[model samples]
Target: MMKLGFDGKVALVTGAGSGIGAAVSRQLAEEGAEVVVADLNGDAAQTVAAEIRSLGGQAQHIAVDVSDPDAVERLVQFVIDRCGALHLAVNNAGTDGVRKATADYPLDEWHKLLNVNLNGVFYCMKHEIAAMVQNGGGSIVNMSSILGCVGLPTASAYTAAKHGVVGLTKVAAIEYARMGVRINAVGPGWIETPLLLDHSDTVSTRRMVALQPMARRGTPQEVSALVCFLLSEQASFISGSYHLVDGAYTAH
Candidate 1:
């Protein structure tokens, strides 16, 4: 039998306060890993960690601003200091605001998307990889998007940023594959995350489903399922790979 256990290992998930990040943190803990739930929203992260603990799973909360290099370094150091070894990391933190045409996209919006979407991943990886290498080896999963693989109509900055994520994952994956570390990326399609619908999730999700081959959007847990598998040793031979879970959106 192929066991998907994470015994005696430590897993860190960024943006774990809610949505897919939270789902991944919970699932990883259920599989027997000591999980660090880090998010820019401290209270939210703590809440998720508490839920894991309530379920008899080991978890703790840390406030992390992935866009900030210093903060990312401290996050990795926290895992190393508290857990003694860092085994797995998920750079799942990101942001995408209202869609605007490239010609009208404000500079602030461009900077904002790039800062959290692309630069943040780089910051997390730099620190996480450094710590993982020191402790021998570890695995990393970067949360990219279908936007990372294909161009979207009005998501110029988001598309560009995600494309950068795919490139970064490939380069880093190749660089660390033989050195006891592996890096991969996950591209999620239109999911009904709270982040996607601040006001009307049901209506928004329906609109998105019209474009999907599945005739429905995905769930945070569904995305987390693939994420957990990629984080496990069962995926040992999978590195420098960008796995898509876009509900057949990209297939068309």
Candidate 2:
């Protein structure tokens, strides 16, 4: 296996306050990349950045609502102004939305879910792509879910938004391939995140685990490993693809 490194690279990871996002930020920093830990929760973002600094890694925190296009644009600009270039990005900010059947799903809730999970990724990608192009090239990893490829009861909105991410990733990857930008989507299974752990006893959680061939939930570090690889030169020829870290959850 080839050892990967992000020496002198600049990376931006949204939702970096916790879970897979935080793990990715740390991993990138460990690999010598100057990382930006971005999240809507300012304090959480700052905490993560502080942790990275303590580990002797270069990192900073930025607070922004990814659902807002203006905020997304400003995020890119802030990175450039501070770091001088934007080379790697992981659009990991997302929400699970309200759990309800499609017919019973609240209208406002649907819009809210899509705005962050789907539109948020789009907004980030739009500005990130422009910046990457100007910098000559870069890589992006959009966080999707195994739900993106399969349906789940009472998760209609979340499912739809994730599916949309996979589609959007494909289109963006193709359009930007010639320009040297490689964009891809990552479909994670039921990772052991705080959000999932909080619902560990729920029927939905049990069902999710049973579907996985591994018969257990994955970890944030596991997903982060894949995201970092996709963002590195080791995956040079990989683009416009949806890589799943779901422990064969969808194998059936």
lDDT string, candidate 1, 70-188, tens digits: 88888888998898888999999988865777899999989988999999999999988888898889999999999888886667998899999999999999998878899999999
**What is candidate 2's TM-score against the reference?**
0.98
Candidate 1: worst-modelled 10 consecutive residues by lDDT? 199-208
Please report the candidate that would top lDDT against the real structure.
Answer: 2
The CA lDDT at 233 in model 1 is 86
Q: Which TM-score value belongs to model 1?
A: 0.95
Question: TM-scores for all candidates?
Answer: 0.95, 0.98
Alpha carbon deviation, residue 20, candidate 1 (Å): 0.3
Model 1 lDDT, residue 230, Cα: 92
Off by over 4 Å in 1: 199-207
lDDT of 2: 0.94
